[model samples]
Target: MEATSSNFTLSTILKTEDPYSSLMLAVAALVAIFCYFWIQGKAKSKNGPPLPPGPWPLPIVGNLPFLNSDILHTQFQALTQKHGPLMKIHLGSKLAIVVSSPEMAREVLKTHDITFANHDLPEVGKINTYGGEDILWSPYGTHWRRLRKLCVMKMFTTPTLEASYSTRREETRQTVVYMSEMARDGSPVNLGEQIFLSIFNVVTRMMWGATVEGEERTSLGNELKTLISDISDIEGIQNYSDFFPMVKDDDEKAPLSLTHVKSLLMDMVLGDSIVEESHLPKLPYLQAVMKETLRLHPTLPLLVPHRNSETSVVAGYTVPKDSKIFINVWAIHRDPKHWDEPNEFKPERFLENSLDFNGGDFKYLPFGSGRRICAAINMAERLVLFNIASLLHSFDWKAPKGQKFEVEEKFGLVLKLKSPLVAIPVPRLSDPKLYTA
Candidate 1:
């Protein structure tokens, strides 16, 4: 009876107070505590390092709601006053590290360039730019390198631009004659359309071996203009897919939904196929005009988002890996630190200076910088310069009756005049002699 009682007591003790079970419970609780802290630390870090500071962000959406659609640059400038040049703002879920100062821009573009080289194309930009096949829209890779090289060597070569010089001269001569005729008739001429047409003629002729005067030119011109207009509008950027990918649902109707709009626009412009190289000049000035236009009026005053690929210090702050980066070429170009009277219209700034737009100089990268700089730089520049030069040399321009040269700018993909540039044209008697031969 004594032994039995002893065994029963031992059994009771084992059942009531198990050492192994208690130890296991303690271990599980410790693990849960550790995991909680770890997750919290990670979340804090993802919010990014202590940035230069800006307006407070809401949960999830961040400073997006605070952003004004019409005056994006102005809004950004306002934030700059509170937060120094290098500041951070969250646009929806995306983190935007804006570099308003030239010094910080230099560091981002020059020192730690590779980290910020890849581009993230917004959905609207992608659809408008031909499924991102064109050099400007393409990401950094073999295709981009190949295209870039081809553009430099075969298309935009000094010899190629020189060869196309006569094309411009001829176009200019025609424009001068047209203006002279219009002046003689005393009829109101749409100088803006004339200028646009003249440039378009020259560029298209060089690219596709046809001028805008051709039978199909009107249709093509309308299509091209529509495409450009759609791409440049602010509403395009306001789409939800650009900010919140998960919110895209076919059944849900939202102001920001882009599905139908993008589809229709793409159908009208890209309709049926890609734009082949045969459709464009294999040379540079054709590309240059495009680049210059963007510089004058960048499609996005701020480039797409970039991330710090590696941990590094910039402008005295520790820029951790995956930290968002922005290069404000618009502000940088305007800043006295890099440019003089940056607001003025001066294509001569490029010609006068040794500064090239190859992402080397932070002062004039309309296309952004680093590994992800614009793929279409070579082509865009060639097109823009070719056209601008062609128009200026071809005609002597005058403001329409009672109209002054208004350079009021409207921002989009490229800066466009708030009012399409309308002017009067008086033909030069001796165009070739009056302008540089």
Candidate 2:
């Protein structure tokens, strides 16, 4: 058997069972496994849907260089047009499946929802949120469900929101007073900053009766705004460490460092009382405006990258296990094929349609869909509606003289206005005393 060419096959060598022969057999087995996968991959390329079509990736950097920080969503949307709706992108060594079309979004978010419920956060996100322990980054299971239940039952329920109306009204009135003084002085006001401050005050007041005054409040508000802006900026950045986990992400010194994440993540407002939930039914137009805003600018452009627990087929393509899935809601929301005048700001489109933020509708998932959908939808809706309504009802807004108001958006963890909304507010209320009422 040792000398004969006829018995030189691996089976004969393995059968010899000598120490050297055994070592040779082990090496042969490893080679066989490697070749098997190589041949299988080649066959799959010919016979299976090829990892969904995608733009050719470059070595090492992959598609990283192509994504600009200011307009990453736009860049990704452009790639979808060239690569089809469901595109495969390589970010460093990581493989990301980008679902751009509503159909593809449905597949990832609905049809195979459970299979892709878990999120894969970047290293900075993990370190900031305490190893992704919070509901947003938490893996789907009992812990996530408990958090979701707390939000749905204890925090954002209709009754809880209704009880918060007094706080909402109080804060809204304060904003009105501030705006009135601005109107009297004919001074330009940063509407975005104003709205943010009003909402922040209302939320904090409801949560713990927290109050700030004078220069201190303004300083704190500016700091919080900057913190939010920084978080959004970091969330949009493509950390190579996420794509190549083997590499140290420099978590302490990363563009989105652990410190920044801690500051943003640690600041949470626990609240109960807010806007009258009953009034929501009557404010159809407000809801419509929200829908339109979400359609144009979903808070989370990519909706926390989902990861499949097991390999599965989506849109006829083979999705390997643990592959990261990016549901590009921003791209889907602006697809011309789905909505007329997709890029235009038209709340009227939703006035006649039944599309909503609920996870059921594939064509319009601003908050997302499936088991991993945003848990704070109820609270968020009320907060946004009440704040916007209060701003509109208390004063009429117009851009300051010679200043043009534009809807240009900056992409981030949450979409933001490229410029702070600067406007002149004219008092709408009949009596100045009403501001305190």
Q: Evaluated with TM-score, which candidate comes out highest?
A: 2
lDDT of each: 0.58, 0.73
* CA error at residue 369 for candidate 2, angstroms: 0.9
TM-score of each: 0.66, 0.80
Clashes of 2: 3
Give the poorly placed runs of model 1, Cα more than 4 Å off.
1-49, 129-131, 187-192, 214-223, 234-236, 250-300, 304-313, 316-325, 338-359, 366-395, 430-437
Per-residue lDDT of 324-353 in model 2, one digit per residue for the tens?
A: 888888988888888898867677687798
lDDT of 2 at 411: 73
Clashes of each: 36, 3
User: What is candidate 2's CA lDDT for residue 157?
Assistant: 85
Candidate 2 error regions (>4 Å): 1-49, 249-280
